[model samples]
Target: MSKVGIIGAGLSGLTLALALHQQSIPSIIYESRPDAPLNIGGAVMLSPNALRVLDRLGVYERIRTRGYTFTKVDYRNAVTDTVTEMQEFGGKDKYGYDALRIYRSELIDVLLEMLEAAGVSIKYGRKFAKVLEETERQVTWEFTDGSRETAQLLVGADGIHSTVRKYLYPDLVPKFTGLAGITAAVPTAQLQAPVDLHLPLTYVLPGKGGFVIAPQQVDGSEQLIGKQRRVEKDLTREEWAAFMADKESQVKFLQDIDPAFPEVVHRAVSNIPHDKINVWPFYVVPRLNAWSSEDQHRRVVILGDAAHAIPPSAGQGINQAFEDVYMLSLLLSDTAKENNKDYLAASLKWWQESRQARVDQVLELNKQIDLRRLPQSQDSDGLEKLNFEVGWLYDIDLDQVVGNWLKEFQ
Candidate 1:
């Protein structure tokens, strides 16, 4: 029997299966989508911390040639075209792996392949309905089809709107941050960019928000041009679908270029691929009282966006999720030994607290980056120029963490 039953076959769940398999722990994944794993939002960015986890799981080498790698993002003055600041997202020499931007489907396909090689099973078309029962030793849940399954532990990695989370907080809903990011893909040749312009940049339009141009694809032929704006009201699903379906409106929304930015900005918005348009409404799950059940069972667990849909400023959304599953898998192995039943609750508590601490750090990093984006003011907020450093974020050693924590109990 599968020791761990994972709900959702996205990055977190698939990666969790691999991590568990490495520790000789068996796991099964349940995905609602009948045909494929949950692969949306186009391409995703990965920093060093996540790269380390993927490398350890033997996923990085296979995907290395399928993505564009970079180390820094230049935040430039839109008018003068002068780089105002630089943020290092990754560095092989410093953090041991460069940042990667790859298509969501490509990564998911590779993960699925790896899971197959590892003999991990994934059940498609299985939607998690709700928790049927939970005890100190195991968990059982039902699907929307009325079928039931049980496992030694249940993990909810079901993105932002998670059904398993309902078992913990019945009324909880993801809080929209009142901002929506609209973007589209365009050929790099369309921009006709200057030779020295660095890629993956945030061109700060004078008073308006930043306009982003990030390169993607194996050859960097395509770039994602994006901008965000305040959204006062949250649209319904049908409304969102209609809004996105109108290609004319999406073009107009992205083409609202400011006069302060370079002519390249106007050129980048000249022709956006209709099929490549994407809109991401920012939503965050509030800091929860518990990521796991508070009772003695602690059988139902939630990670990734299910627990915290962190702000995207730091690009740690999926990266941090990788951290969660990997660390949890390692800890789960420790508890698998005989006579460790007494420490089950304590182990989970420590895991949640430890993961929460890193997530809190990432949030703080987001605030710092946002503050840095403000217009240079000699007076307001009294904010001094701060250099971006990510050693603490990327240089983490999860094995050391597991070992150190076990020592406390040993």
Candidate 2:
């Protein structure tokens, strides 16, 4: 059987490993972090687009048990305390699946368990440092620990700062979107539960200088979720705190909004400090001229964030990476069967051509979202414009979206 080496054990890498394992394809995953669980952030809104992939991976039900489902979304402007837009998610439960608000850790645990049950091996602390292609038949990877291994193909699922991407496209770098967002999970007991916490999975209140409020149920318990307004790039902790400290300015703007909404916002601004929030510096890499290397002798590929990094505005980052795993597996299963080296090289080329265009479109949409959320005047018209654009983003379907993307590869 042909061997595959995947860099990064994140959502993308692990999902790819599981999909490959389903075909009885063997692969090893190398993660740079210590062999321990790290708390990266609080919760995430998993739309049905991503849920479909989890279903195929056989862990959807497990995740659902630990998450909360809701059927509607509300968008409001904090400055004037006006309701900007409210949309029904077409009633997800009516369609047999509902959108979910889940703790990030719970989602990771589910993915990790599914991978292990399939006997997939993941080596932590094995940082990807370099890739060296030997003779036409094999490729070797150099790790931070001075260890090396060769395989028929190398997959760079390493995330935003992918070492594989650096080795392949050294000149390209992830450009910060000048937008910094902060997120944290506080206990449900802290907030007065929504009148119908069980009905709506999330509530987003957009604020000036780039802020949003999302209420999610992580473990069937309500949690007050808050995110800072989007900025141009990453912010220092001090800068984030300073923005939150502008109490008079924020209160003057938000005091009249629905009592429940501002109560949550006021508590968020007053209670949570920058140190307590998980702030991700938003960045993206536009589609490149080519996502694969030349020469039939060596076969190395990039998947997920390593190839295309999208901001969280669209919530498609994980789902798109899952799409990458699914399509790549389909191509490789047909060509790399029985360890056929010649077929492996041809398969990767097809994978690249098939996935690049679609990935680029997703990236573009995220950029559009980031741009639309910039600080706007405290007027209903401006907020209305923002809502029109934000609605377009949350309403995308991953399976159909990516299916058209892979049509060419077929």
Candidate 3:
């Protein structure tokens, strides 16, 4: 009961473990996979907010140069090819770190390496079945293998289909957002793009949607060319998995481009290797009344996608997960000495409310981006195009935020 038990060894869970270790809090990671976190996410774009967390946890330096780095995402007119709007992903001059597009595996490797050096243990192939019980001081859980374990705290960083989340919301399911990102990586040269062409560009055709061509890799040798699809009828989790596994169908989806789409898009999807494609269905977890149980014990908790899975509109899906891990660690460390249930409960309340505000902001940002990308978004109703001044998202001070909350409540 001296450490935390973390479910899911994915980015969020591993990062949480390291964040706890940095506070001298020992923990174990239980991953359902037989090996390292399933590296299926392809490459992820990390903005400054998430990078700051990694840098603080000693993960940035290891990966800063391993992937492509850029600062802006250009939304271009499909016909004129002129830029219509831009989203500031990150800026070394403004945010102290440029956005990074690194493979998920590379980042996970660094986290696992750090934890191993720190002597943290990871129980691979140990699937989390469900939370068995929660006491005032500790929580216990069972693995699919019938094994059980207890810890001072139990965290479900176990992603959108989280088994751990079932303990908190027995009937809750991740609602499909009617969209899915269909993507594939091809050599940057395949596009034969004009030299002046922006690296991360989205071309919008009013009625259809955006076609994205974004560079990846440290040398910018490859790019991810993708578009979103609307699924009228939501599929079960198993159905979605099967649909994603159908490489031929996924490739066909990407290739089903409008003739009016830019030539670059056509070329980009011309010869996608079946092995390099990814199908990411958008799913969102409804806002929960509590990230922790209503029971006074509140020993079991959830974070990352398990708590709130937002779409990748502002490319904050991973970035926001990083925030959750970092902020929770700060809050826990702030109240470690007292270990007062009242203080812990208050801190968690503050954490959820504050994080919810940020998530809400991201959702709004996604709406603005959606307006530009999707046809259905034409019914904007009242969504405002917030000035691109997103310093509030990328420029986060985790310690200061948690500290101020503590002082106010004290």
Candidate 4:
């Protein structure tokens, strides 16, 4: 059997590698980074839809113990300092799995451990350059290191700025969402707020900016993850530097919103070292006519952010990536009998068709959530509708969805 070549060691690529290993498919991952453990991202929320897939991969138990779990979210008005709404966000009873909050590094560590145990090879510092050639039998990838590798299939799980996506569809590009996300994590004990610390997650929406505060466990330490989103785009290096350097002004902005708001969020923001604060501009991938090469025989596919990147408002970015890996792995497993180019091509087409619609829905849902959280929208009904849509998203069962897709193939 020809080994699968995976690009990027991100959550999607690593999960796909593990899922394929479960089905006895041999594969290797080529990461552009130069090291095994890369700690470059902030906290992430894993909803039940994603947890269910991780559970199937046999790693959720380990992950569950390393993260904080929450079941409700408090939506408050930053200007009035009043709780507008409280919703049951996620729980096993509601969605058959718990919603977890953990640093992105911890999750990556768990994934790397699983891959190592499975004997999956990951070559670091192997930046993907472009497709060198594609034949009926195999597709070859050239890397920046002036090396090349050939495999039966190439899966691009890089990210929003994916070289693989550019190789497959050079014209498709990610569009800026006109929003920026600033995040930081601090010891929960540092917060001097009088509000109940044990309460559910909280979101304070004021003007055109929104703040999300949730408790998280990083390296066994209790920390609170504070995320702020505002309508800002294409910030230059100097502008970003200036923004980070003025911590006092940022704190004042929070304090001015609501006297109580700063107590809960300001401490976390101000206490974290300036270098530790993360500011990322949000971008979304335009809906593609197809997520894979038009010629099925080409055997090149894209998943996760490469396929469809969405805003973080819905917290479905990582969840949708897990779903992509699960579905693609299942379809590839079904092709094990034939184990040829034809079967591989057919499986890739099925995987793309099976996932594209759901991806479209999730992207649109994230957009709607962003709109409701905008400064102009203060209606409780909009918040309620956003909550309902989120619940609907987390309730989807990828296993059942794949089972139905298999029935059609049968």
Candidate 5:
């Protein structure tokens, strides 16, 4: 069997490596960052679908013990200071798993631990420079350090600014969504809001701005993951500095939305160190014509944000990445089992055919959710629409899909 070269040891890359390992496939991961276990960004919501994949990878139990699980989502009107809608999170009953909120760093740590236990090789600081060459059977990747590695197949999970994606399709680029977000995590007890701290809440001021507060546990400390988004786009460094420096203005902005909103904002801004607060613009990869190279050998394929980057507003970015990992790993496993000359190409074709439509649907659904969440929308139909979409997303069983695909090959 040929060794697989995976770029970027992110959620998708690590998951793919683990999935391949389950089938006894050998693979190596190349991470650009120098840190062995990189810790960046805020919390991520793992829907039942994501949790199911994690469970299969044998790490869900560990994550669940470290993360926060919630069964309800409260949608509150930031202007009116009232709960506009409430929905029950359908986890075990609907999808046979629980929804979880875990910090991005915590999730990375868990994945790293599992990878180490499995004896997977991950070379850090190996920044991928470009593809040096590709033959009929293998592709060679060059690193910024002038080092090079060759593999039968290359998978790019390098994220939005993926160098592999650029190497394959030079014309494609991620587009900014004309929105800016500020995210921080603070102790839940520090929040002065009068809402149930146990449940997740989304406060919408409509068009002006909005935020979400979800309970999470990071490094054994009970914390509240807070995220605020507004229509500001292409924010400069000085603008971000000004925004962060004016803490009172931020509190007042939230206070004007609703009295309770200020409390959450205050807790996030005051309690969290200034450097920990992240303020940046959001970008999404435009729908791509192809997610894999045109090489007849199928030498290169991109997954996760490298293939389909979506805005964070939908909360489906990481979830969809997990889906990508599950499907690709299964397809690759099937290819390895068959040992057919064209199996790799056939498997890559099947993987894309199975995943592209689903990715398109999620992308459109995310856009709709973003619009519905805005304050200016007069329609109250977002709740029903969101519930339907959530069910559709979280209820999928990738194991069954993979089984059906295998039966076709058999």
Candidate 6:
């Protein structure tokens, strides 16, 4: 049997494990966090591209049962309260999936449950501290506890501050955007009074770095939405709490942006303490010339945040990782059949070539989103073009991207 090892039990890591399992390929996952569910105070959108991958893993029905499918995407000017662009999501029944909005924890639970059913073992508290690749046949991992394990292939699905990334791209660091996201969920009743706009999975309010508000449905549970301010990353925890402490102040600030803003911001305030709100300093590893070695055949490779960490502005971070898994899984399957063997080296090479470009394109789009949030004076005609051209993002096709991999593999 070919042993595949995955580090990190996050969305990306778990998704990769599930994909491999569907292929009847066995793998093990090592998680640094204690064995417990993480409840981050935010929601995420799973585009049709991502939904297809989940469905193939047999988790889509479970996810849809838990989340709300959203068809329309609307963007508005935060200052003028004018709708800038609205578009219908393009990819659906073609692959039998649609965009969805769900809570972070709910998504985690669904993936974890599927992984468990696959008989994939996730060793929690076993942090990946170091790794060394000797040859195509052998790769070793050193955990924080001084324990070690060897595998035929090692994957670094660990998130942003990935120990694997550091080992590979030792000189590079994810650049901070200077923008911070303060996210929290609020009750629907609290929002209905001040703002009359029917919400979608996503809404953008234009301003200095602006705001985004969207609904998130927990797995088979209740629905909730989040409102967040895009601000500078320099604020301390104390500053963030103090700023949100006064509901009147938050309301007044929203009023300046748009009369309807208060309806959204106030709801966010009521759900969690001004203090419990999470302040995320967005960062990304910009266009990397490449993610593969000189020969393009190595026992190690990165997936998810470790490979292409990007800001959430476009909501592609998680979706992109799912795309990676779908594409790479197909490639590996093809390589196995062609060689009539494991063919780990050829699989890694083909996977890298197939995935790197798509990942780069998504990273660039995230940059465009960041540019759109810059001060009005900094905006240009190009930025205006981007606001109108984001339709592709909402309409990506994962199966198409996977292309030949499906034929050669499946």
- Model 2 lDDT vs. the true structure? 0.63
> Which lDDT tens digits does candidate 1 get at residues 1-410?
24989999999999999999998989899999996887678999999889988999999998988999999999998889899889999999999999999999999999989999999999999999999889877898999999999998899999899999999999998988777778899999999999888998999866566889999999999999998756788888898788778888878988998888899899999998899999888899999879888764888999999999987888899999999998998888874453566566778889899999999999878776666553432222555556788899999988888889888877
The lDDT of model 3 is: 0.87
lDDT of 2 by residue, 11-104 (tens): 7888889888876789999889888434465676666556666677687889887866765555555555455555443245444467777777
Task: Kindly list the per-residue Cα lDDT of model 3 for residues 1-410, writing each as its tens digit.
Answer: 36899999989999999999998888999999998686876999999999998999989999998999999999988877789888899999999999999999888888889999989999899999988878888888899889999998899999998888888889998888788889899998899999999879999987778899999989999999898887887898799789988999888888998888778888898899988989888898998888887564777889999999998878888899999999999878764545566876777788888899999999888888888888566435466665677999999978788778878877
lDDT per residue as tens, model 6, 226-325: 3345465545558756665654544434334444453454454444434334555667776654443324336677888788887675677888888887
Which regions of candidate 1 are displaced past 4 Å?
A: 335-338, 373-385
Q: List the residue pairs that clash in candidate 1.
A: none
- Which whole-number lDDT from 0 to 100 does residue 381 have in model 1? 53
| lDDT (CA) per prediction | 0.87, 0.63, 0.87, 0.73, 0.73, 0.64
1-410 in candidate 4: lDDT tens per residue?
A: 35789999988899999999997889999999998744655778888888888999998998888888887667776666667766555788878877788778888999998999999999999999999887776788899988999998888999888999887788776887665666655666676656554444455555545676676773424454545545556565598678766766554443443444545656655566544466666788887766777654656888999988887767888888999998888777775446454665556677777677777787666555555456454322344344444666678777787778667665
Question: Each model's TM-score, in the order given?
Answer: 0.96, 0.77, 0.96, 0.87, 0.86, 0.81
- Candidate 6, which segments miss by more than 4 Å at Cα? 37-41, 78-80, 87-96, 193-196, 201-209, 218-276, 290-297, 335-347, 367-410
**Clash number for each model:** 0, 10, 0, 1, 2, 2
In terms of TM-score, which candidate is strongest?
Answer: 3
Residue 407, candidate 4: C-alpha displacement in angstroms: 2.4
lDDT of 4 at 340: 53
Candidate ranking (lDDT, best to worst): 1, 3, 4, 5, 6, 2
Best by lDDT: 1
Assess candidate 5 and give its TM-score to the true structure: 0.86
Backbone clash pairs for candidate 5 read 206-375, 207-375
